[model samples]
Target: MFIAGDGAGIGGAKAAALAGKIAALDIACDLDRLTAGDRNAAARPLRRRLVKERAARPFIDSAYPPYAAALAPQDATIVCRCEEVTAGDIRHMAGLGCLGPNQTKAFGRAGMGPCQGRYCGLTVTHLLSEANGLSPDQTGHYRIRPPIKPVTLAEIAAMAAPEAIEKSKRSNVSTQVNG
Candidate 1:
């Protein structure tokens, strides 16, 4: 499987778009939709653009490093606001031999909140890394669990009902016609 954008470590919209294009070209070549030569020809420009987009990251990082407060928050400071997990709590987990963010969940529910680690994943990783004397790579990220919203029984029933299906089709047609 081809991973692109932030998953591939290339951030920013333009860079992600370029990465996506490159992946698409490679996938097309693999599927024989395009020859290897054609794929390379198409990807050359995308790679150049991706490089240019990534080049600015160093300057931006140097210009504006992470906030010290975020990197080293007070013990009482809530790092994972959704779960109300404190920086000190994460440190305590590390002291207890919690090696990574995933382990932190068992210790204090740090990455088990509604956001599922989107907001606090990096901070938790950093805290664990620092406390355990491990690199961020070694103090790995959360094993993501997708957030599930509470669904009502009526919602489930509506999904399978023929009347609901007919209503949905009519609504779609109305929206299309009105637009």
Candidate 2:
């Protein structure tokens, strides 16, 4: 491969042939009129801006004021029901003994609420994890069962035949057998 660039426009044939073998190509008409240092200095600001914007923002739960406030107040109206657990309550439970979401729920009644912790489960886990000194992953998310939102017996009756309803009940039971 050969590259010869002088006054006249860079020869396209030569450029195409050397393209693959070239490691870096700088095109500057009147190349000798400007020094390499001058070009590099001009690129500094662009390089700086790229570096500044490349950083990632922290996770929502990690930086939000509401999250910090929630952790500070236990009786704070826990937003989710499935997990009757509150940040403050979990903190209290952690002080007592249990250190995990499952244990905390079992003994403290946290995350066991009606909503089943769906809305507040993650928040509760985040708070409990911090309070109990557990990892976020260790808090383990809640088991989302069928009919995540409660359905009334009447609703089930209206939707299915008696046998179907009974089968649903059995299936629901089987679904949660290990849960």
Candidate 3:
């Protein structure tokens, strides 16, 4: 659901909380029964009373400041390693009539990469917001395209054979000519 990113930008806190809950709970729940249609089915068989477990105390270690990456660096440092798009590059797009992340992406390939903007989307949004004098929400992040099916290494290797590729190409050419 949070493909573009959560509002806080970092989802580590939620992951950390889930980890804490899993560690604390001693319930012997079967893994397979956990599904949308039958959530808590395994737990239901146990029928153990589940009182509201108080959330663990918030972890506080002032030793390091909480997430400072997004706080600063209004500099021209390269943000999108995939596209080599810098903060200045994003701002320049803004100055050149690019209002939001999508526009910048279309204009300069800022978020178009193998990583699919996972690494640089947050930074691009920040830069766009600052440049356009709008909030991050206003200069929204890129919309997620539908996910393609994942392929295994073995599947890729099988497709790499030259004879297979040539056969496929010949079929494609024949179909095109007939059509």
Candidate 4:
């Protein structure tokens, strides 16, 4: 049975677990020929255990990607709101021999993703640097912007008129300070 997951390999885990159950039922779970056209073949006992065993690590590790590979470089988008950039745009710019974080930001908007590149900046820099054959450090720092998320005009107005809004800056500051 096919399963979908967060792309962290959860599907492989589930397949392993299911294979365990199938092994218990069928008593034959050989996995030797389980690849490619072998999936349609009868389950062998050893194959079931192997499937379960093989699936465990991927399942557990599926929680997150390796540090070396943050998101699926190709699959993951490159736009950074903090930088306001997209991956494709970054690649295109990189192809033009652009380098450095500041340069990348200026050209590709690396730190402009919706999460302000808090989620994607470093990873993007790494990928871009690798593609460009530049040192990661050369990928200059991204622009540090305020209010990463979009604050509506109404919200700004409320903040401006704290007395009218009742949630004054003092209260906000006090909450933050106290917390």
lDDT of 2 by residue, 4-82 (tens): 3321222344433333222122343135544677645654554454334333323433465454655445565654455
TM-score of each: 0.73, 0.39, 0.49, 0.37
Off by over 4 Å in 2: 1-67, 71-86, 148-179
**Candidate maximizing lDDT:** 1
> lDDT, candidate 4, residue 156?
88
As for lDDT, the candidate ahead, 3 or 4, is: 3
For candidate 1, the per-residue lDDT at 17 reads 86
Rank order (by TM-score, best first): 1, 3, 2, 4
Candidate 1 regions exceeding 4 Å error are 145-179
lDDT of 3 by residue, 83-164 (tens): 8887778888988989887787788998887777877887788778888899989988887555587889998898778788
**Candidate 1, overall lDDT?**
0.88
RMSD of each: 7.3, 22.8, 10.5, 17.3
lDDT of 1 by residue, 20-118 (tens): 999999999999999999999999988998998899888888898888679878899999989999999999999998999988888888888778887
Model 4 scores a TM of 0.37
Best-matching candidate per TM-score: 1
| Positional deviation of residue 130's Cα in model 2 after best superposition, in angstroms | 1.3
